[model samples]
Target: MTELGYRHGEQHTPPPARRVTDVAVERFEHVFEVDPRLMTVHVAQQLFPNWDTLRIAAGRADHLDWMHRHWAHTVVSGQELLDDITGADADGPPGGP
Candidate 1:
């Protein structure tokens, strides 16, 4: 028989734990209608760093689609969307349409 130390077929070995985060990352492609996956994640993090990844992904899908439909443009830049929708100038922050 093989030595017990580092032997094959160890019953004590534990299975790898599943992670929701990894699933979210894999499912991240669903956001393609918004923009590039990595770019969208980066911009989202910048806008809401404290947000959960799942929340961000869902919010992005809703917010981007809403803005695209209402504003009549595909936007990757949050600030640009804000400025355009709110009619804000380069020097001013967005307020309203």
Candidate 2:
């Protein structure tokens, strides 16, 4: 009879622990509601490709510093466009006038 190599009691490396920040918690509350495991370190890294742990823990992180660098420009552009629309509306003649 051939011996089996697989063991049912084998132990595996545990996943890294996650400590979500207040900002992340607030923004991702709904994500947590839907998937409580979304706050894991691995998931955070996957979602935020360019995140810098050092910066986050050191309190020197900028608004967009630890975010995915690829999305930075897109977010900024969108915000700028929104601001432009707001400004245009504010400058236009009053609707009831």
Candidate 3:
């Protein structure tokens, strides 16, 4: 038996680690009612018709880093987009419009 418990002499390769792209795709699907199996490149193209696949992939890491920083800053800075979307202003009471 192989280390992965396959029959003798068989080869096995593990799946790749989940990328930030996968999380983005999952979120897009959940929020936009897109098909779960739709590829990330398709989603990007739909959102940004001018962007090519290679350019999208190349910016993934930098975009993720920027998002992380934005989220961290939002946590410290208080409500911004979410507040505006929900109609809850900083001067208004909690959950108020």
Best by TM-score: 1
Model 3: what TM-score?
A: 0.21
Task: Give the clashing pairs for model 2.
Answer: none
* Per-residue lDDT of model 1, residues 1-63, tens digit only: 865554333323323333345233232334322222445644652322222444667887799
Candidate 3's C-alpha runs over 4 A off are 1-51, 73-97
Over the stretch 3-97, how does candidate 3's per-residue lDDT look in tens digits?
A: 55444222222122233463333222122223435556555524332223335555875786788888755443346657665664545766555
The worst-scoring run of ten residues by lDDT in candidate 3 lies at 8-17
Global lDDT of each candidate? 0.48, 0.44, 0.44
Off by over 4 Å in 2: 1-76, 93-97
Candidates 2 and 3 compared by TM-score, better number: 3
User: Between the candidate structures 1 and 3, which one is better when assessed by lDDT?
Assistant: 1
Model 3 residue 44 CA deviation in Å: 14
lDDT of 2 by residue, 1-97 (tens): 9887644333232123344553333222222222335556554523321123333434543545667464555445678878877877888844534
Candidate 3 residue pairs in clash (backbone atoms < 3 Å): none
Stretches off by above 4 angstroms in model 1 are 1-51, 73-97
A best-first ranking of the candidates according to their lDDT comes to: 1, 3, 2
